[model samples]
Target: MNIAYPYAVSLEEDGVYFVQFRDLEEAFTQGASLEEAAFNAAEVLTGILAYRLDHNQEIPAPSAAQPGERLATPGVEVQSALLLRQARAGRSLSDLANAMQTSWPAVQRLENPHHWPTLKQLDKAARALGKRLVLSLE
Candidate 1:
């Protein structure tokens, strides 16, 4: 199963930026900038998920975008997964938008944890990030 969670990447009064997941409210990772925050967030998510799997805890029930608001799409978790993968590869939002020849805001909307992407767009994003997406019915 897949799960999508909130990620608030905000710039504080200082020059530093941080990313904290809604699912892991108690935990937060910070960086000097958005790129670094995105990178560290990926690491944090990997560790968090690994801990859950090791402890046999149920994955957080896809709580980011609500159940039906996204329509028939690849689901929030998968889109988040793609977002993380691209972030891991050091691909910034502008980089991806440039590659896809779209506006930066379009890609930003696709990556924002609370928003949803259409199924076709999800596929395009995954492919852009060097990932393969599959949908399974539970």
Candidate 2:
């Protein structure tokens, strides 16, 4: 599933552009211009997702974008971590490690948002979870 979250951008009375994610109430930012606002939106989204992952908080699924709402995606590291966690689906880390033929700690690191797993590692994890890794350009 695509991991891009839908966000609404509005121009404030003071001329700043405000961006807010519907699914992530705590994620919001403002910029001086539309371009800056878009950029800030992505950064904030990534930060919030990373925070949630680090804190073991629930990561909400991205809702379908409504008309006039733009999509903001988190960084690749966050995406990879979330995807791996979702694919595991409550399976134990040791179970996944056995399936991937890797050490348990290694498998644990795959779900760490701060650790950037190689593509090969991600693909192997995906395969072990009976899923295929798919990448796309927005």
Candidate 3:
């Protein structure tokens, strides 16, 4: 799934610009100008996704952009959580649990948005999936 979600920008009567994500009703922000609004929109989106991830809530897939829509991406943490789940491919959660020397429920929690994973945990998970964990600072 694409990290960046589409948003609708609108100018209010007070001359402030507002941004709301089409796929995320909980994500919204405003700024004095279009540029600032867009910037704030990104921050808002990241926060929303982070909260959902932290709460083990479902993260919606980015919707296709309509006319005049802008896109915003989630933060690295959220991306990592998602990638960990996606890396499983078609393998059952139980398979990963066995690989990690744990129970299936434990493996499931690793993919849970609300379950905060440490770096070492993520590294182990990547290895279990036959992948390497790579990190870079943007």
Candidate that scores best on lDDT: 2
| TM-score against native, each model | 0.43, 0.97, 0.68
Model 2, TM vs. native: 0.97
Report the Cα lDDT for residue 24, model 2.
Answer: 97
Between candidates 2 and 3, which one is better according to lDDT?
Answer: 2
lDDT of model 2 at position 55:
97
- In model 1, where do residues sit more than 4 Å from their true spots? 1-4, 65-138
lDDT of 3 by residue, 1-138 (tens): 347799999999999998988788988999998889888988888778878766757777788899899887766666776787668877888889889898888777776655677888888889999998887654
Q: For model 2, what is the error of residue 41's alpha carbon versus the real structure, in angstroms, after optimal superposition?
A: 0.7
lDDT of each: 0.60, 0.93, 0.80
Rank order (by TM-score, best first): 2, 3, 1
Best by TM-score: 2
Q: Mind giving the per-residue lDDT tens digits that candidate 2 earns over 1-138? A: 789999999999999999989999999999999999989999999999999999999999999999999998889999899989988999999999999999999998998988999999999999999999887876
Candidate 1: which pairs clash? Answer: none
